[model samples]
Target: MSKIFHPVSEQEALAELPRLRQRLTAKARHAHQYRGTEGKSLMAQAKRALRWHQLFVSINRRACQ
Candidate 1:
């Protein structure tokens, strides 16, 4: 499958921040709850969390400038 990319506008990024934070929180909670379980999708959750976190930081830095 081909990867899909959509460039985020400043306004769109600002709007997405809250939703992304919420999803990150939920994913984190899921990962924590399954910490000791084997074969869990922890890696996937971590990747998503990282992606959202990076975007969030980038947006904040841009806003501050």
Candidate 2:
């Protein structure tokens, strides 16, 4: 199945960064504590999301400056 892509504006991305970071950290801790497949899966998904947000934020920041 294909996933639909929705573009996020720089401002929105910036605002969401903090929440994404917090989620990633929480997922990481849970994964470490549980050492279970579900935790690992969730942590991986969070990492992917945060990576995307970070990349978008960095690229946009550079472009705008």
Candidate 3:
């Protein structure tokens, strides 16, 4: 089996950003709320939030180009 990677169009990427940002915000809130109380899950949520940040940068960079 193989996976295909398709870069989204600039307009599509721009449209998706707001949704991703909302997810990032939710993940950040989860991470913060569970901090200390749930170390493992908090770390996981934080990692996911970080990935969203990276994706935001990547998508924005591509859109700029």
Candidate 4:
């Protein structure tokens, strides 16, 4: 048997957006909990959330392409 390599379309990527958002939201909350409310920890949590958001955007873009 052979595997197929198909291109991902923008519409296909858009279709996955809801699922991705749900996942990222939960992960953000989890990360926030792990970091807790503090000086440095809070800052780290914020940075993580931002990075997750960036990664999510990149994933969507790449999937679309």
Question: Best by TM-score, which number?
Answer: 2
Q: Per-residue CA lDDT of candidate 1, range 1-65, in tens?
A: 01233444566666777887776667666675664663257657666676876766575555545
lDDT of 2: 0.71
Q: What does candidate 2's lDDT look like per residue over 1-65, in tens digits? A: 01223455678877887887887887787686665588778877887887877776776665555
Candidate 4 per-residue C-alpha lDDT over 1-65 given as tens digits, one digit per residue, 9 for 90 to 100:
01223344566656766776676566556664554355456556656766765566566556545
lDDT (Cα) of model 1: 0.62
User: lDDT of each structure?
Assistant: 0.62, 0.71, 0.64, 0.57
Quote each prediction's TM-score. Answer: 0.45, 0.52, 0.47, 0.42
Ranking by TM-score: 2, 3, 1, 4
lDDT of 4: 0.57
Locate the minimum summed-lDDT window of 10 residues in model 1: 1-10
Candidate 2 regions with alpha-carbon error over 4 angstroms: 1-16, 26-36
In candidate 2, residue 19 scores what lDDT? 83
